[model samples]
Target: MDLQAQIEREGFPPGTSVIPLAEPGGQLFRATQDGGTRGLELLLTNEAVRMYGAGPSLALVLSRLRERAERGLPPALAPGVYERQVFVGD
Candidate 1:
């Protein structure tokens, strides 16, 4: 299934804005109503904690985004892309 279809299957709230990334592995970013943005990435096989990594499921990511929206937090980073380290933990 595609990202949007998966999200709908996962039952994310209606009108949730998800921007699909051009990269592989179903990566995407969700924008909260409060203007906060979070990048979501799938974990590799057996991987645990890591940078720019989302939770084990899309539901979790939606829940987190909901919380952020309620809190009205500003965007964590600027619009442009930048290089950053991504560490995968066991």
Candidate 2:
């Protein structure tokens, strides 16, 4: 899948993983992902939030969402994926 195109479709940031965190059926959620990463980085959607279980594809992802929820604000979510180490493989 085309990463940049997908971000455009979802209205996510250009350089970021987590879509802006937001509750389901709510306003536009925003998330941050290290643009440096490659591959199909997952965006924790409401579907992931509803059940909070989705085949362990995003265990660490959910943890970050929890942090956002605790903040009770979208931009308040800290430790955003502004810069981080990532692995790429072929």
Candidate 3:
């Protein structure tokens, strides 16, 4: 998907880490900042994450990331000023 592609090409930002606040398989993505100091640990997957857009892999991850980015992820969501998500089932 474009999300992974962008991450692989550019990245989330200067300070962001895509982490799994609650994922079914426990797999996750982490986007960090310089010196590995401050950043956002956005929830990659929660419960039974799905998609209304693309593939099985990028759907939840990208959706949650966008959700967190727009709705303002919780402070503890990540390591610093991270974010959160609504579990796929919840």
Candidate 4:
């Protein structure tokens, strides 16, 4: 499945925007509910997905993005992975 499809399966709210990256495993997305931006990268073997965000929550995420935007930095940054997901079969 594609990134959008994965997000849909995860049940994120609507109006989310995702941009594909040059790197095959990476993508950038913005949440519509609060304008929070996040980046994710899929690991090899599809065993894991990594995520990073500038802010902790929807509100703070948008705030940080706006600050970055105002300072001429890209809305998304070179962030360290803060989360890792591994799916387990039931």
Best candidate (score: TM-score): 1
In candidate 4, how many Å is residue 62 off?
A: 16
Q: Find the 10 residues in a row with the least total lDDT in model 4.
A: 41-50
Report the CA-based lDDT of candidate 3 relative to the real structure: 0.44
Model 4 agreement with the true structure over 1-90: per-residue lDDT tens digits: 354454444433344333323334432333321243343322221112322331222223334334433343323343433132222112
RMSD of each: 6.4, 13.0, 5.5, 11.3
Which of candidates 2 and 4 reaches a greater lDDT?
2
Q: After superposition, how far is residue 61 of candidate 4 from its true place, in Å?
A: 14
Worst 10 residues of 2 by lDDT: 81-90
Clashing pairs in 1: none
* TM-score to native of every candidate shown: 0.39, 0.23, 0.38, 0.26
> Using lDDT as the measure, which candidate wins?
3
Counting clashing residue pairs in each candidate, in order, gives 0, 9, 6, 0
Q: Taking the tens digit of each residue's C-alpha lDDT, what string does model 2 give over 23-70?
A: 343223244434323212234454444554433424445344345434
Per-residue lDDT value at 7 in model 3: 52
**For each candidate, what is the lDDT?**
0.42, 0.37, 0.44, 0.33
Can you write out model 1's per-residue Cα lDDT over 1-90, one digit (the tens) per residue? Answer: 565665555544444454545434333444433333532222232232243354554455555554544455344465533222222443
Which regions of candidate 2 deviate over 4 angstroms? 1-56, 75-90
- Which digits, one per residue and each the tens of the lDDT, describe model 3 over residues 12-69? 4434555434345434554334433433443434334443322554555655565444
Q: What TM-score does candidate 1 reach? A: 0.39
